[model samples]
Structures are given as structure tokens and as C-alpha cells.
Target: MSGQGTEPEAMKIVLVGHMGAGKTTAVKALGGVDVDELIESREQRTVAEIFAADGEGAFRDLEERVTLELLADPSVQAVALGGGALASRRTRAALTAARVVWLDVDADEAWRRVARSPTRPLARDERRFRALHAERQEQYAQAADAIVPASHVRRLAAPIAALEGMPAGAKLIWAVTASADYPAYIGAGLITDRRFWPATIAGRRVLVSDRNAASHYGALFEPVLTAVRIAPGEQSKTLTQAEVIWREMARTGVTRTDVTVALGGGVVGDLAGFCAATYQRGMPVVQVPTTLVAQVDSAYGGKTGVDIPEGKNYVGSFHQPAAVIADTTTLGTLPPAELAAGYAEVVKTGLIAGGWLWRRIAAGAAPDDPDVIAGCALTKLRIVAQDELDTGVRQLLNVGHTVAHAVETVTGYARYRHGEAVALGLLAELRLAGADALRQQVLELLEQAGLPVTLAADVDVEQVLLATTRDKKRVGEGPVPFALCIEPGRALTGQPVAPAELRAAIMELVG
Candidate 1:
């Protein structure tokens, strides 16, 4: 708030995240005050002498005293918080006025940094260090309004400068994935980054693009491989397209060692990923999703497939891609309708992943806002990374999709794009069944984002029921486990709703 309207005015920048994320280094870059100097000033007083005056209780008090004193100076604007500061609810609340930046670092790099640094108090050994690191990462993630990856600090300085100019409440986010750990680079401008694309795919790679996405930004990927263009939209996301890509792969003499690059949105990601999954009994796949819908949700996950006349993604395999590249620059070319449609997934993500993230999205934050997009993507990645097979906790990601997918199926996929239909379905389901406040928030966000809150008149309730009957989430001889959005960051499933009630709800939305 203090830096408002001034280009070079000082703003309080607080560093947060897991231990050893180079918070100190970043603070040094900003010419921050030295904490050790303050401690050194009192060197004559031993730990025993300090505790003797107040005991362990008082010693803890002194720590906060020193921290507060350090932050009191107007010139001392930049503060590097200890990794555990946010763990203290009082500390996080006190720092509400400052610009909180969560320094994003991968688990492996963080572990290595802590291992090499002897200054860390909690990281005395590898086993204990990793335990502490993992525990704190989630809390740090929750506390920050914006996230900055410390992995490329120097390189990202220019972008950081640009980000610093954002309004007081603006949020920015950056997505990062450790090398070969799992395919995680699904962000704008990431596909064009040489760091994301390995050298191995140069001559051996083939690119598959759909009409809508291929018409623009297709040239960006031309350097990656020989391009094979396909028709765009949900209709093109079928087994036929998969076969065509397979044929291309075969004609190009692609082998098991070779990779196929999917350079479009979700449809292309699914279709080309399916080809990579089945070809030569499974080959490498790289995803370059051009739309916000694909980048934030579909592209990173391994579930690749084509829709059959029977059900959605019925003919797909769990073939994980080698990497995912998303370029935000491509999003600039999207129609306003497309951008609004994509925000549906962003809302759903908030419903499932709660806290400040839910609050931000509910507040009508734009998807292009780094904080908004990164927060949404981080929630998805955390869930998927923990349970790639979706055998357990990952089922939460399907919130609002059950009825939404049914809407798409019954309407023949053209009435609304996948995201638009989902937005409508979520509204109906929440209005009828979820918590009142959350339902209202979802409705407000839908209206604010310029998406529809009701289904088309032409959609048949009976056909929608029939579509629901075959949902992939159906459990042992009962109603399919539909993720019902109730509270922000919470979902309920396995609650059997009567078919009559569901039909009534769909009818209410109809027209």
C-alpha cells in the first residue's frame, strides 16, 4: 500500500515458502537489512543470559520482538521470513499489509539447498529435513498472495520487475516442475522455453495440431517437428483423429523411442496423447496446450483419450506425457467467449482447493493473473502428483464435471463448449444441493465471468439422465460418485441423490 502510484517507491516484500528457497538471496538483491547484524549487536548477551531475564517463554518473546523491530524501519522494506513464520497464524496475520511472495522451489532443489546449508536450524539431517520441508510447503503455499519461482531468479528479474508494478492486491503465479520427475510444465510461454523441451525429440518428434489451435501459434512449434494438422473442436476429438495421427506416426517411421508432440488445446492433447500412448505399445508424448482450459486442467494429467459415441474419454489410456508447454502469449489471441468459458475450470478448481485461492477466484480474479492461474494449476498438480491413478483423494478434481459432462453428452457437445457446460452444471447442482454461501459465490463468479448459469432449452432431460447413467465415476452397482460442490475447497460424493431429484434439477436449468 505504501508504494501506491510511485514507480520506484519502496514496497514491503516478504519472502515465504519451504526452507532453503533462496529467500535470503532475493532479499539481498533488493538491498534488504541484515538480520544477523541486529543479532550481532547483542553478541555479548549469551543464550543463557537472554533466557535468564525471561526464561524460554521470554526468549520466544524476544524473537518476535527482534523480528518486529527489524520490520519497523521504513527503509527496511524487504523482509525474508523464516520458512516457518507462516506456520504461526499470528505472524501471517500481522504481515497482511505487506506484499507476500511465496518463493516457489521444487522439492528436490529445496532438499539439496537445505542439505548444503549449515545455517538451517530444522534441517539438521536429510530424513528430518525432508519431513519438515514437505510439511511447511503446503502452509507457505496457503499464506502467500503471489508466487515467484526461485529456480530462475536472475533470468526472471525482468518479469519480476514487470510484476512488481501490479496493483496492490494483484496476484502473480509461476508453474515449475523438476526435471523428469513428472510432466509439470503446463503454463503460458513454457512451450517456447528451451529448458522444457529436451534435445532428444528434435529429429524423432512429430507434432499434431487441431484446426482452431493450429490456425494460430502453430508456427511456434514448427521448430519442434513435422506438423500434422487435424480439424478442431470436440467433434475432432474422436477415435478417427487418433487413427489419423497414428497413421502419420507410422508413415514417418516413428518408433517406440520416438515422441509425438501435441500442439493445440485439450482436444489435440487428448488425441495426440492417445496416439503416443498406443503407438509401438507406448511412446513419449509432449503436450503444448494453447488454451487456458487445457493448460490449467487437462494437459498435465496422463489421462489421454478420444470420445466414443458411447461416453466421453471412453477410449483413452493413462499415458503420461513427457512434458506440457503452455504459452500465455497464445491466450492473447483467444476470443472473449473462449476466455470466459475457460474460467469455469478456474472456478471448479477453487471449489475443490479452498482457502485464499477460493477467495480470490470467488472475488472474480482473472485467469491471466499469475496468482490466479498458478494457484489453480498448483492445486491440480498436487492432487494428481499424489494420486496419478485417481484411486483415492484425486476424485475431488471432478467437482461439477459429472452434471457438466452429462450436459455436454446430451447436447451433442456443440450447444456449449466443455467449460461453459460445466459452469452451468455447477450452478444448478450447487443451487439445489450445496451450501448457500458457496452456491451464491459460484453463481456470482459465473455471472461476472460472463458464462451461462442455465442449460439450453433444446437439451432433453431424459437424454441427460441416460448420459449420467454411464459416467466413468459410477461405483459398485449404485449412483455414480458425483463431486458435489458444497463448501469452498470441499466436495461431497457417494451421496445418493434420487433420479427424480436430478431430473428436476436439470429441468429447472433447462431454458
Candidate 2:
């Protein structure tokens, strides 16, 4: 609230996450105060000892009181909050007036770090500790003004230092993967904010944009040595277009240090990123995603490619970007159909995330909210960090994309938008999962969002079914590996659905 409109004011930037997230260490690394240390120094006892003597309820009361005191103090710039501090509603509400950064840590990593430590009182039980980590992630993500991986924090100080200077209401999501890591800046006016641009783009830039995005937003980026403008739409996202972009980069004397600015929707992001991935054996890319679908899903993952006749994204590479700047203001100019299409990914993400984000979508949160976009981005970031190549847990992020890609393939990529096909595909996958109630709920939500819950008139059900067998995720001679949502917040990959059931699900989409 302090930096939203009027002149800047003092507001505490608090770091929070599960136990073993290294909050105290991160605070020290950033030169910020640690409230837990302050509390321990006053009590003359460790936090574990205090918890043992006073119990969690009593400890929380003191934590809430002192945390508020620290946040209210004008001199305190930032503080590392206790892991359970956000469990208090009043303290969570107090964060509204503060800048909160969620220092992210996976449950396994947290457990591994704190398991044998005598100082972690509540971390004695592995089962309960993991459950609590899952439970608290929803809170941290919901309250965070920015989300940063715990692995990146000591180094994160540089980016966090730029947090307050971002456009009002802006949010940051530090995306980490096995290949590379980058910062995702989501806000109202990030495109023109030169100060918010990553240092990776400080040198010359070779932009890859579509006709629409170039005419609309291309001129805003300064000192771009050259640009390769291609036709808009998925139809143009092909190796042919990628070759066009490669030629232009070669002609412009582009080199490894120059950045590729992907300035458009998923089409441009995928094609340009593919070109950059191969050009000079991997140059850095800065994804300036201007569409809802791209901002929420494609821009951050580094899975860049073009569609071929065989299947969607059949030829691709794992080329992570140097940065992703999603200026939400661009969403305001999108057509109604594009926004509705984008909402499908939001629903798919919420279903996969299944806790705070699902509740928000069920309650009808708008797709354009920076928090919603950042939530979807963070969910994928967490998945990619663990399984960048989609060889394992990363498949969960494809809960609805398997059939969606098939739909796009059989329909020749023209009958439905990527998100629209995904909306229908979600219903199909839920039907396959036999989650009748959840499927109905998602159906109603998609219908409300103006998405097509049924197959298009020209789509061939049998062809769509055959296309699924050709799915890029398939290996050997088996059926396409399916990722299913058993319930909110839980998903499993590599499931086999019988042919009869697959037909039923696809047929259901027809009606």
C-alpha cells in the first residue's frame, strides 16, 4: 500500500517460508535483521527451547506481537520471519502493509537440512514436517509480494534490492531450473521500466517478435541491434519461421553476448526461444511475454520449440531464458477470446497447485491479477527446479496438456487456441481420472470464463484419439503417458488409461 500510488514510505520487507528455508541465514546475507535472533537474544534461550517450554500457541502469540512491532518500526527495512509466523491471521493481515518475500524451499530439502538438528523442535517427525511444509506453502505464496528460491537468496539480495523500485503492485518470482535460473518480474508497467530490466539485457539485444507485438510494443526496447518480425498465430510457429529468425540474427552479426527478446504470446516465445537456443549454441534470452498464456506458462520454463506435422512441440530444446518480464498491462489490450483462453491454464495450474490458488480460482479471482499470474509461474518454477527435463515430477505440470496437444494436432492448430483446447482437454483428463465432481466444477468455471468445454464442430474424435498415440511424451510402443489430478493439490504422472476409457473421455468432450 505504501508504494502503490502516493510517494514512497517506509515498509518492512519480510522473508518467510517453511523451516530450513534458511531465513536467518538469508537475512544475514542480505544485511537485514533476523527477528528470531532478536527474540532469542531477549529470552536468553534458543527458539527450540522456547517452543519446548511455552508451546506453539504461546510462542506464536509472542512472535505475532514482536513481528508486528518490528514491522511497525520505521527504521527496520527488512526482517526474516519465523516459519510459522504467517499461521497467525493477524500477522498475515499485517503483511498487507509490508513487502513480503516468500523464500521458497521444497519439503524434501527442508527435511534434509533440519532432520538431525537438535535446534528444530517441530521437525522431529518426517511425516508431519512434510505435511506442514505443504500446508504452509499456500500461506507463503498467498502473502508473498515476491517468491525467491531459498537456494538463490544470498545471491537474491541484488534482485531483492530492486524490489521496492519496481512499478507499484509489481511482483517477482525467481525461476530456478536444472539448466539455469532467472527472475520473472510481473507488474503493471514493467516493459518500459529500464531500471527493472535484468543485467543480462544490458548489452545489445536481437528481438524476435511477431507482427502484432512489434507494431504495438517493440519500439519501447532501446538499442535493439535488429529484430526478426514474423507472422502472428500458431500457424506461423514452425521451423520455417525459426529459420527466418536465425537468418536475421546471423545477418545482424549477433553473437553470444547479445540477448533475444521474445516479445509476444506463446507463439513468439517458443519460436524465438528455439532460434536462440540453437543460434551460436545457446545465447541468453529475455522473454517479454505479452499474452496471458505466455506470461503464465510458456515464458518461464525454457521449453522452447516449434510445432511440426507430427505433433505439437515435437522439435524443441530446454533453453532457459535469462529473464522473464511479464507486464500485466498488456493483458488489458487482449481480446475477450484471448483472456478466456488464458484462463484455461490458470484453471489447470490451480488444480495442480490445489490449495490457495485453487481456492482463489474457485472464488472467481480474475485471471489478470498479478498474484494469479505469479502463482501459476511459481508453481511451474518449483516443478522445473526438481525435474527440468520432464523426466519425473515435472510431468505433473502437464496434467491437462497431453490431450490438449493432441487436439491441436488433429485440428491442424487452427480450430482452437492453445488455451481453448486445454480447457476442453482438462474436462477430458478429469473425466479420465473419474473425478466427476471436480470435472463438473471445472466445466462450470470454464463455461463461465467463455471457454469451450466441448470439442469444435470440425474436430474429428477418432483422429484426436489417434493423435494421442503420437504424443511426444510417449516412449516405445506404449500409450501416451497421462498426468491426472486425483484431487486438488495432488497429481500423478505415467498413468495408463485403457483405450475404452480414453475414447469415453474424448467422446465426452464432443458433447
Candidate 3:
């Protein structure tokens, strides 16, 4: 809270993100200036117009000059970087002294924000902006010491105030409690934040993370808590792993108050959550959901469990966390396929509680867009809050997931990322004739969103059907009920059908 209410100073803080991630808007706000006043340029032609006439190289030169001149002026209050500028070695080096903040936006919203602008040089007639945006996400992470959630931009004062007088990358407090009510504070330095680790875990806090996450974020957890590394992948979500985690907890003599930190993606979250829940009948768990999938779906809910080989999520408990920290920074390290897989939950969230939000995603919304994530998360939170127990209303949230989980199980989890499988399942579930138009529209959106509408070439339809039969959700002696799309906003649950129809749905995906 140190840097607030004071007159603007030197260029001590820098805002970075992919193109059209609202960095420019955020910078203008921080400088207490309007964009109209700052940009006294060569005719307000759209970036497209400039690129069409002068070309990309010309635009890049202009951009570089604008960036360099701004960074040089000590009086420059704050600076916002165009996405490509950070890619330059010289420009990045200049930022070494400043507190760099990354404005994380999803792909669809990124496209939406830039789509309205005619002046974007990058958006110039690029149909592959989705793919390209996905490609550059990791690059943005390299430049940021702290990631500022775009969702918090509207409520800028609190987050910015939290950043005051701290070191360049010191963590800022950013908690979201609308529905699930979780605490999250980010930045490279948050590891030391009194708020980051609960006093509940006094003598020592034990953190469990996978190999991949340990390599990246283990350092952050190690100094504050005793972190134990585990292997990665869904296979790790097993009773054996849970026992190992419990043994570590027991060996450490962890108390009810002592916390267990689940430091990886959903698998870690699920396994660690289950371990924490089962230990002492329930222990406080702090979820640091690393992957996009965990952040948007698995991490927020109190539902934690491990999958038995017989089925997914077979044994578990409702172990809510003291806090759920979603560092958008971690998502920057995710691979392209992993990124796409995360979007499946985003799509499902939109389908169920997201009335208009589904339309946004169905239109091939960008993940770098904050609005898309906000809308999706808000809807998801609403549903999760209502059905924290998931008996009735919240069941709609599984629209594509019934078939999707089956797909993952049958394909042996390694074949397809959960989101990719869900994307395909969404297409299949949407195919029940009544929602044909909407189904086609969704398929088009999935394609535009750089996802697969059909099953993978290697997937065995028969195995998937067998897995579907084994799903715990099966009602009576009949085909398992699936949440199907009646329209964009309306989804029907418990829609029973003949086993043959279910097989045909899988067959259609295969064909």
C-alpha cells in the first residue's frame, strides 16, 4: 500500500502481456492519463490500416521508437509494452529496474479487445491469431516478475495498493471470494507474504507437488514449508500416492491446524486434497492450482479425491482449502496442448451457468481475454456455490464431462489432455438432433478455438463405451445419463438413451 495517493513518479513500473491484454489501458489508468492525450500520432488510422499500407516492419519500427522514447524519459510515469516489444533484447533489458506486472488475459477476450481496434498491427488480417496468441503466452511470462490478474484490473486500487513500496517483484494480495471464497496473492515474492502461508501450519508446513511443478515453484514453497516432490500425470492420482502423502504428513506429525499445500495441477490438487481430507478426518489444505484446468475447475471446489484404477475420482472427500492461489504466471509455462485442454472446462462453464458467456466462447473467444475468463469463472463460481454438494443444479456443469471422463479413462489418460477430450465430448453430446444447429455452431467455435471436434485417430470407440458403462453416474439399468445441450444456455441432465445410441454417438465422433 506504499505507492498510492502520491503523484506519479519515474518509470519504475512496467505493464506487460500479449497484444490487446489491456496493458495499454492499465498503464493509462496508472499514469492518471487518458489514452487520447497520450497518442498524438500520425492520423488515428487502425493498426490494420498502417500494416496494410506501410507493412509490419514499418509498424514495428514505429512501435519500437515509441517504446524506446517512452522508456528513456525519466519523467515517464509508467510504461505499457506492446506484446512484441518485450521480445526485443534491448527493450527487455531496459525493464530490469522496473517492477514488471503482467496483465493476464485469455485468448478469446484478447481477440475481442483487439478485434474492435483497427489500429492493431498484429491483428492485421491474421486468421491464425488464436494459434499465434497461444504461441506467445510463454514469452510474456519470461518478462514478468509478478502477474496481475486482468479480472482485478477494474478493482485496481486494492491490488496496486498491495504493491506499494515493495521490491520490483514483491507479491501483491489478490483474493477472489465471490462464490467459493478463496484467498490468492501472487507475485514472485508472495512466497514470503504472511498471507501466503497460513499461521495454521505453525512448526512446519508440508507441501506436495509433482516433479514438473516442483522444478518451477518448489523454491517458492521450500523456504516457508517442507515440500515433497511427487511424479506428474493422472496416474499419480491414486490411493498409493495418497498413502505416501499421508505417511509424510504422519512422519511430520502434522496437526489438524497444520496445512497441506497441493502445489501442482488438478492431479496434485485432487491427490493432495484427498490426503489432507482423510488425514485426521480433515486437515486444512491450501490449493495452489498450477494448471489452467485446476484454476478454472478443480482447484476452487472443496471436492477433492483420488481416482482408483477402476474409475476416475472414485475415493475422495470434501476438503476445502484455507486458500486457493491461482497464479496466472504458472499457466504461461503450460504447453500448447495443455492450454487447449484447459479451455474445455472454460467451455463447460459457459455451457451450464454461463448464459451469454457460452456465446462468447462459441464464437471462438480468446483465452487471453479477461472478460472471457471472468464471465466463465463468475458463472462457474455461481453454480459451484449453489451446488457445493453437487446433488442437483450443479450437475449441469458436467455437460461434456460425462463422455469426457470416459474418453480419458478409455484412452488411458495419456492419449488426450482432459480439455481436448472434453472438446470432442462436447461435440458428441451436442449431437442429439434437437440441438443440431447449436451443435454445428459449437463445432465451428471449437475449430476456431484451435480444438478438436472429433475424437483422436487413435482412440478406441469401444473402449470409451465400456468406460462410459462403468461411470458411477449411471442411473438404473439403462444407458448413463449425459448432460446434453438443448441450446447455448440450456443443458439437460439425466437424458437416458439406449446403449446403441451412446455407441452411435461415439461412432459418429470416430467417423
The top-ranked prediction according to lDDT is 2
For candidate 3, the 10 contiguous residues with the lowest summed lDDT are 1-10
User: Candidate 1 vs candidate 3: which has greater lDDT?
Assistant: 1
- The lDDT of model 2 is 0.84
TM-score of each: 0.69, 0.90, 0.62
**By descending TM-score, how would the candidates be arranged?**
2, 1, 3
What is the Cα-based lDDT of residue 271 in candidate 1? 88
Please estimate how well model 1 matches the true structure, expressed as its whole-model Cα lDDT: 0.69
* lDDT measured at residue 219 in model 1 versus the true structure, 0 to 100: 63
lDDT tens per residue, model 2, 1-511: 2245533235567899888988888888766788778988999998889889999788888888899888778787778889888888888777767778888888888999999678777789999898888788778876777788888767776556546455556777888777776778887778754435754346688888988888878888766899888888887889988888888888889998888999999999999899989999999889999889998899988999998876667799999988899998888878889989999999999999887788899889998987788888888888888888878999998888889988988877778888998998899999888899999999999999999998866788999999887887899998789999988888889999998999999998877
For each candidate in turn, give its C-alpha RMSD to the true structure in angstroms: 9.0, 3.0, 10.7
Candidate 1 positional error at 169, Å: 18
TM-score pick, better of 1 and 3: 1
In candidate 1, stretches whose alpha carbon ends up further than 4 angstroms from where it belongs are 1-81, 84-180, 186-203
List residue ranges in candidate 3 displaced over 4 A. 1-204, 368-370, 498-503
